[model samples]
Target: MVEQDSTFLLIIIALCLIFDYHAVLLPSAYNQTAISQENETRAESIEGTLIPSEVERFNMSSMDQDYIEDEMNYPPIRECSILEEFKECGTACEETCDDLRQLIICSQECVPGCFCKAGYTRETKGGCCIPTALCPLIKRSTVCGPNEEYRQCGTACPRTCNGIPEDCTQKCVDGCFCKEGFVLDLDKCIPESSCRVTEVCRENEVYRKCGSPCQEICGVQKETACTGCIEGCFCKLGYVTEEKAGICVKPEDCIPPKYVKCPGNETFTYCGSCEGSCQNQMVSCPTECGSPRCECLARNNYVRDKFGACIHISDCISK
Candidate 1:
């Protein structure tokens, strides 16, 4: 019994020492817990490494504030204002120094000429701005000469030249013209009219001058009215004769009669003539050559005798 008790006492003492070491007697357990918590906290801190600050940011100046001056430069020049110019020009303060300034001045106080396109011309009361093509007056004098109306046109278009104040030379105006027979025409001097007589011809007529009177008036003959006159004959005032096939001539002609046949077989046979079939055998022909049958047959055949009688061509030739 005593040995069992002693053994039990020793076992109890060892168990108590182990419990105290783990609970409070020794620091191993607490140290391990502290180390584990420190490692966890360190890992968490490393995960969020970046730091923020409250410092202010630097600023920059604007481009406009850097290069621009606070004041205007240049002298005042008095000149005509161009309608299209952005700024106006004023009196020049000083000749030499002002001239060097950005201001531009003209010889006289005059308005600027109108705006001209690249290839156009612009004229103003003071002067003109002409393109090379629109107005070729660049090298030419403004005034051509005395007594000229046209202004020497230059490379500019829509330009006006001095009229009557300057005479037009070839170099002055676009063109020059003079009256007929005068020395000058279109900037060129010419001779007078050479024709001695200027004949005026009327409608349907042309001027004809021939050596003989007959030759002069011969052109007036109508082909249908007078095919041709006999070799030795001339056309009469009111009537004309035509040459037949060869030698025969129309001494008597057919004319419109005063009266016409009204569908009857017999006519007045005088003071009238018929063109159609003369069924009216007695109708009178206005020409009064002779009997109706005789005149009709004779005119158609052209072998009629002077008395309006029809004769056979062979008989007439034989006679």
Candidate 2:
């Protein structure tokens, strides 16, 4: 009876050992192998964060409880292999609180809509959020800056620029007029030193020089002195006379003419003239007549000279 009892006890102990090995040890080993493979796959992705969608997929998979528990026991995987990466995933590390508060650095050419923390402005250089240290602050829903003029009369400002009155409000800076040397013709200020003098056609009839005044100048109607000559009959060349004649004449003719008696004819001489023919090329003088030629001059052949001489112009030409 003792020997039978010993054999039965030994059989029972061996069965218990086999059952424990298959149930616990084998499954544990398999779970470990699966978890190791999972970690290796996660390492191949770009970002260093686990994808939540991938975790969902993994939980939904038919993996056994032993494998799932083994996965949950380890630290969160650094990456995800099953799902695509989240675009707006926080750049900060969850392990550190400081990283959460700090804004992410960005490339110089980053586009708009990039992630930035609140209380920061998108820098002109990059889309990165920069502290609004120098930028205008919004107070009472108003934006005012150092250089810019502000008007806070109402919810919507009565006007935009501050310095000038509302009626004359424009984008003027400094004084209202153009800078020195420059005339205020255009909308913006320009260097007046470059401009030239005005073009004056006449004293009162001054017109801006061609391409000047930057606009039209004193019109013809403004010049009352140029009345008769308005249509255009200016004095002859080498002349200096006013436009009083209403007609232009030689500069010398501007004054009255003098009268003299025709030497031989005793006729008044307005201008030099001769009757038929006269000797000694008579010139009209009040008291007496004078002549250079002693012999009589031909009437037709020898025409009158400008000085009332009866000498032929043909003779003069021939001579």
Candidate 3:
């Protein structure tokens, strides 16, 4: 009976010791976690990552706490690898070539670390960052259009069949573009020889000094009439222009003739034969009303396109 009583007392004592041990450790652990959280909370600003408390300060005046004035010393910058600089607050997500294959959104919060300098990115984890031009281009099974290929730094303003001007102000960018001696046409790269800028116009299409966009057409209406005269091929005097295709054909060639009355841009005339298309236009022709039709005048800058359609004279191809 005594032995049993002693054993129960011993077990009670052991339980008390265990409770006291946990009670003593719980507060300590809680204080440590709270301090750590408080320190992290202090890192609100971007400039300084850590603000040292009195305990954290190494050397300080005893009587008066004059903190360490050295800014660089407080935020110790570790030695970084080549091509890296210490950023107080910067993105840690360095996109690698392999990483680009999948989409991974990175945290936007301030992350202090060594990052690659501008114009550089890592090809892989722990690898040095390099310029995109130097990076191995991701290969594609598909080929570019005819007379086109990918370039590291190609012109953003490619020359098209219309002979659009190159934008000198634009910086070089990467992409597929026409190779030398070729031009872009309808989004396809073709030999410059085949482009309309150099090719011969079809029959009845004379390379006139001026052309009119307000000329006749099968079916279409222009939003903005060609303001000034342009240089390009135009239809002869006998034929009018097909509005939609910009092709030129005889007045009788108009399909259905549903819109035979007049073009939206042109004013109908009671006297068709002498209405206009005159070199001097209205001034030369007197009003002697007769058959009705649409006509163009030189002052309006009317001319013909390659297909013999009337176009703005300014559209004429330059010699």
Candidate 4:
């Protein structure tokens, strides 16, 4: 009975080995052998023995278990995804809108896998491939007016009369830009020579191709401490700008800011000209350096009251 049982076990292992050698992956006709043929010589010698050694038996059992586990755990193969097709000889190089018009030399070697469909290219590197017509660079072509040229990818903030920004975040854009020797002015491309003529500088203002953004403004004096330059009309030397009015004036000519008014007689000032608090009535108090808010009325001969309102010097003294 023991000899018969051993023979039966050997037959079952041989059948498993034969099935493992001819196994195929699902959804495809590709052949993939599971076990190595080096073990075939060792398996052949075991057939002569009535009962195989424990090591030989363990090896056979492991080989059979590996084959069974592989078939049970094999993942289901899927068809091509959207905008992709199974090609027998797919190109190693991918197509994109940036280089779609350029010539590409692809290998004709067999590489059976999914690839982008006809008339479609990869949208971005390792991104969802989309239709060729939907590409923004394709649509932007020939959209420029005379003297202007279309760019597939260029600075969105083009060189204007004000000047191009140094730190331009929106650089990757496809649209009409001024051609060489041309500058954009009021949404129209004109000769570089006439760029300044279009941008007429006002009095006490000068047009700078590359000017500092930090300048003297009303109640705020500063020097250029910027990382980049700004192109536009800037206040000339010995001149300061009143930003709200969009005009330049001398430092002494800057009108005290009155755009903001407090309740009652109190007025707002960027450079607090008044230093009188409600508890301290100072009609002729010296202006101190600080972020002075609504406290007192400068040059109005008034002091702050307890209710945060400005009152005449005589009224506070009388109380």
Best by TM-score: 4
Q: What is candidate 1's lDDT per residue for 1-319, written digit by digit as tens?
A: 4355456445544543443233212122111111122213222121232111212111223442232211112232222122212123332221221122124454654333223234433322233323334222222222333333333332222212111212233332243333334333234434444223435433322232221133212112332333322222233333323222222122334222445442322222222234322222234446333333223343343334344344544455454
**Residues 50-106 of candidate 2: C-alpha lDDT, one tens digit per residue:** 323455656764655444446446443222112112224443322121233244564
Question: TM-score for each prediction?
Answer: 0.17, 0.16, 0.29, 0.30
In candidate 4, position 262 carries an lDDT of: 59
Model 3 Cα displacement at 266 (Å)?
34
What C-alpha lDDT values do all the predictions have? 0.30, 0.32, 0.52, 0.60
Candidate 1 runs further than 4 Å off? 1-62, 66-175, 179-189, 195-200, 203-319
- lDDT pick, better of 1 and 3: 3
The number of clashing residue pairs in model 4 is 1
Predicted candidate 3: what Cα RMSD to the true structure? 22.9
RMSD of each: 45.7, 35.3, 22.9, 21.6
Of the candidates numbered 3 and 4, which has the greater lDDT value?
4
Question: Clashing residue pairs in candidate 4, if any?
Answer: 162-231
Q: TM-score of predicted model 4?
A: 0.30
Q: Where does the lowest 10-residue lDDT sum fall in candidate 2?
A: 211-220
Regions of model 4 farther than 4 Å from truth: 1-142, 165-167, 196-217, 220-319
Better of 2 and 4 by lDDT: 4
